[model samples]
Target: MHQSFISYKNFKSLKGSVVLCAAVLGLYVVAEPSATSAGGTWLGYVGGCLGGVLMVWLACLGIRKRKYKNTELLAVGWVSTHIYLGTALLLVVSLHSGFHLGLNIHSLAYAFTVMVILTGFYGLYAYSIYPDKITLNRDGMSRDSMFAEITEIDEKSLALSEKISPEMFAKISENVEETKIKTSLLTRLFSDRSLKEGAIYKAIDFVREQHSGSELIKELDSLLQEKESLVGKIERDIRYHFRLGWWLYLHVPLTVGALLSLLIHVYVVLFYW
Candidate 1:
């Protein structure tokens, strides 16, 4: 029974978040201030202040993570707090604003906060699932080893294709040149189409359709099949790696936006309200 950050310390962070939200909710009810969208009442100010502190602390997680040697702040515990407190911030802020989302800076801050939290949840899920998938996909083979084997197969396939016929040699050679094992990031992220376009696939198709069941043809076919399988594995590995990290591109910018908006929000609330 391995416990993850979500269940770290027997769900201590979660319990803390629950207690925090409950306390805020109880205060909001007991105070029974005039239902207003802005943070004008005593309870609203308390919720706003608490939410602000939580948001700032959560944003500091990046710094804490980078300080790997800082044992006083365990990364796992910080991450656990970041997750649970982040979720609680939503409730705290909602109560602070009295659930009145309007088209203003206040609402903009709220919107950005919500987006950041949503992206954080996506990141949590991605981390939970993709690491195991990546490990399983790699198995015992390194990417470099798999790639070297593919190149070896290509060379062997080319040699066998030459022995068969000039047409076979030309097709295999052309396919090899066109086969891009190291491709663009966009190609890796979006399409595994390169796997289908390799020399091995072309050779296999050519052998099946144009040649008889000679021993040479059979050998070439075997080599091509092996190469194709190896190429498939490489494509999958690339895909898994990309999927595991791609969300950060969105998550990071959203988090920055949220933080900036929150600062402006605090300033405006303090000075204007």
Candidate 2:
């Protein structure tokens, strides 16, 4: 129930951002660079240097995860600082550019930085929300446990189906097929909602009409309902698991692109200046 991202870690980072913004503004006010905070000016260089340093440090988060690959830097503080400082980096870089971007590689770097920051925001939002959903959906049953439950349901449903007519056996087979074992991520998440809904309703109607009549139908209906429930649980588990992970697909790639562009930005500014 408690999400760490919104707590003391981010609060400290927010405090740091406030102080940093004040410093950037105070320097700009006092020094008063010509025409703008041009990169050549002392204040301008300060901004660019600060922004560049922040970007490089931000890149360290990736290294920390890969290299450390453990709880060493995996604290809430590291991640929250990374997120908050990343937001601050955008502002610092904008100041560094003196709000003057154009059709140059420098501007391309700016665009990439913006993309990275935007994706970070998305990742933050995703992390804040999705973990809770995944945990709740899991409800203490791990994915392997869910699979095991499904396997047991399969055996029971098949045994029960053998006592029924061919028509009912085919119905059970079709219902089992709806579980959909090998689906792409998007298809697993969104493709079969209506289909599952329709199937649940039809199964409910089947149980109501037939379960009270024939003993065979009654037993088959119980097995059918159990299988349907297991399938629903499995699908939810799949959907939420994907939700927790899919943000990284976009966030990490954009981050690497931003870092590459950032390197180019540094090299060009240093040599060209």
lDDT of 1 at 135: 85
* lDDT (Cα, tens digit) per residue for candidate 2, span 139-167: 88888897888778656665666676565
Error of 2 at 216 (Å): 4.7
Clashing pairs in 2: none
Where does candidate 1 stray beyond 4 Å? 1-3, 34-38, 181-195, 198-200
On the 0 to 100 scale, the lDDT of residue 154 in model 2 is 59
Q: What does candidate 1 score in Cα RMSD to the true structure?
A: 3.1
Model 2: how far residue 214 lies from native, Å: 4.5
C-alpha root-mean-square deviation, candidate 2: 3.3
Model 2: CA > 4 A from native: 1-3, 67-74, 181-216
* Candidate models: Cα lDDT each: 0.81, 0.72
The top-ranked prediction according to lDDT is: 1
